[model samples]
Structures are given as C-alpha cells and as structure tokens.
Target: MGLPKPLRLKHWQDFQATYQQGKRYRGMYLLLRVLPDPRLNQSRFGIAVSQKVSKKAVVRNRIKRQLRAILLSQRPNLAGGFNVIVVVLPSAVLCKYEHFLRELEQLFKQAGIMNHGH
Candidate 1:
C-alpha cells in the first residue's frame, strides 16, 4: 500500500512545481523540498528514489515503501498545506527503517515544519 490518494503528490507537474519553487532541506541520506500553501487543508508528499540509489527496481521500491511508512506515521503531527518532496540519496540504500524515521524527523525540525496548525 501507498500513501492515501489525497496525501500523495501524483502529478509530474506538481512535482516540478515543488522542486522549482520549494525550499530545500538537506540531510545525510535525504533531501527535502517543501513549499507551504496556506490555501490547502492538508499536506501532500512525493518520494523520489533515483537510479543512482540503486539499479534494481526492487531496491528503489523498497526505499519508497519505507519512506511512505514513515510519512504516514508522522502525518498527524505535521503542519498542513505543505507540498513536500523527499529525494532519496545514494547513502540511503543501506539505511534502516528507524534511521529513515530519525533522519526525516531531524530534517522536518530543521525545516521548521514540526508544529501543528491549520
């Protein structure tokens, strides 16, 4: 399973917009591009695992799955209306679920996106 429909950033254009217009936060294993849209009532996310991370489709898919799981668990505490793109780095290929969760939390806090609000 993946992120709920409403919470997933499905369009290529939306992904482009977020990449071009969002503020970037870098972590050791991930990169976050976030754009806050006050008009929205909920946040949406896109996870990117490039070929550089792994040549095998299965590896990339597993990385994406782990990230989606982390995001789902953290969703309720996240602020609303942000378009967030999580780009997986090559360094993440060896990371575990708990490491991914910790990195995401640190990145979110660094980006000032941990508060609850409308």
Candidate 2:
C-alpha cells in the first residue's frame, strides 16, 4: 500500500516549510528532510527525484517506486505529525533495493523519526 492522501505532502507551502525548518538525514541514496507539524497530527511525505539523477523518466519513476515501497513497508514505525521528504541522489540508481531500504531505515532510526522497540 502507498501513503494515503492525508499522509502525503503535496502543496508547495508544505514542501517549502519542511525544507526550511526540517531536520536533515543524509544517506547513501537519499537525503531525508523532516519537519514536525502539529496541525496535521499525522505524518506526510514527499519524494523528490531530479532529472539530474536520471535523464530517463522511466528510471526516475522506478527510483521513486522503490523509495515509496520502502516507506510504505515501514509506515508503522514512523512517528505521526511530521512532514518528510526523500530526495534521491544519482547514486541511488546503482544500489539494490535491499541496500536502499537498509540505509533509509538506518537514517530514520538515527533521526529518531521511527518508533523504537519495533
């Protein structure tokens, strides 16, 4: 399952706000930005993959899908009321899905965004 609408960061303001005020987690494949939002009371997320990462749209979408899959699988572990965005780096294309998931999970853990004792 994918992230629901209420759990998605779509508006430009939301993205901008998260970018400006959020804490950052740098990983091998993605850079995560997270900002706490009290109004929502639930977490929202956005995925960013620039053309610079891949000239082909197919490759970009594939990367996005991989990321969304990782996030969806770990949804229960994430805390609520936060806006998170994952920015893909060019190196992401070369990595295996399991490797990417592991790196992302580690970063989320380090950021304290994921609930403990999972």
lDDT of each: 0.91, 0.87
In the order shown, what is each candidate's alpha-carbon RMSD?
A: 2.0, 1.2
**Steric clashes per prediction:** 0, 1
Residues 1-118, candidate 1: write the lDDT tens digits. Answer: 8899989998998899999999999999999999987877888999999999999999999999999999999988788898999999999999999999999998888777787451
Model 1 alpha-carbon drift over 4 Å, by segment: 116-118
lDDT of 2 at 12: 100
**Stretch of 10 with least lDDT, candidate 1:** 109-118
State how far residue 8 of model 1 sits from its true place (Å). 0.6
- Candidate 2, lDDT over the whole model: 0.87
Candidate that scores best on lDDT: 1
